[model samples]
Target: MKEKQIKQFEEALAQKLYKLDTEKHARAIGEAAYIDEETFISPDFFLYARCLVVVQGKEFYEYVV
Candidate 1:
């Protein structure tokens, strides 16, 4: 993705992560979510090599490294 788009995605992801209640989603893996320019480290899922797609009324693209 373009630099601007990537930045926007990162910002959105950060916001989501900040608001996320780790206790509700916490698993046996770890605590809190980690994100940089790329890659999202989840407690249960570990490392994801690609972006995460969520389909609601429309399509939401979450870019991960």
Candidate 2:
């Protein structure tokens, strides 16, 4: 794909990923991972958690995130 097309696709995919995220889903994984409340509050941790969710693939993401 062209660079512009790739950017558009990435933006769309990011939207889908964000739409899949919910407070309940975030809290569930944080609890499961034993992540401290303080650390969980960090924006970086949230982004990392989201990446982890997507990397697990569609079925797992649907099941957990």
Candidate 3:
């Protein structure tokens, strides 16, 4: 992604998280993988690389919970 686009996405992420109730909200690993050329293998080899999924939408919430 371009620098401008990444900045925009981060801003939006912050905005969305700001409206949540801390007592009921939390963060977790969404998806994770290193995308460098050294790993032409797959996107699952890298562990602990969190994607930071938000607890939103019925389907996504159920998947995480």
Candidate 4:
């Protein structure tokens, strides 16, 4: 993705993740960040995760792990 696209993705992902209050999802994201600093730290994962959130809503929690 272009730098602009990547930046947009990161902003959107941060917004979505910021809305999450669940400990499990928060911790899982944190662990993923630790395991793969490059991927998790970037917002690319947001593209996939945003789709899941749009499709699954609250059930998205089940797939977080």
TM-score of each: 0.34, 0.61, 0.36, 0.35
Among residues 3 or more apart in sequence or in different chains, the pairs in candidate 1 whose N, CA or C atoms overlap within 3 Å are 39-65
Poorest stretch of ten by lDDT in candidate 1: 49-58
When 3 and 4 are scored with TM-score, the better candidate is 3
How well is each residue in 1-65 modelled by candidate 2, as lDDT tens digits? 89999999899769757965666555665444434466535556666787787778889777764
**What is the Cα root-mean-square deviation between model 3 and the actual structure?**
10.9
Please give, for residues 8-44, the per-residue lDDT of candidate 3 as tens digits.
9899656644543222332222232233455442333
Clash totals in order: 1, 0, 0, 0
Residue 39 deviation, candidate 1, in Å? 29
Q: Would you list the rank order by lDDT, best first?
A: 2, 4, 3, 1
lDDT of each residue in 1-65, candidate 1, tens digit only: 99999999889766655433343323323344444436455643532211122222123332211
For candidate 2, what is the lDDT?
0.68
Best by lDDT: 2
Question: Which of candidates 3 and 4 reaches a greater lDDT?
Answer: 4
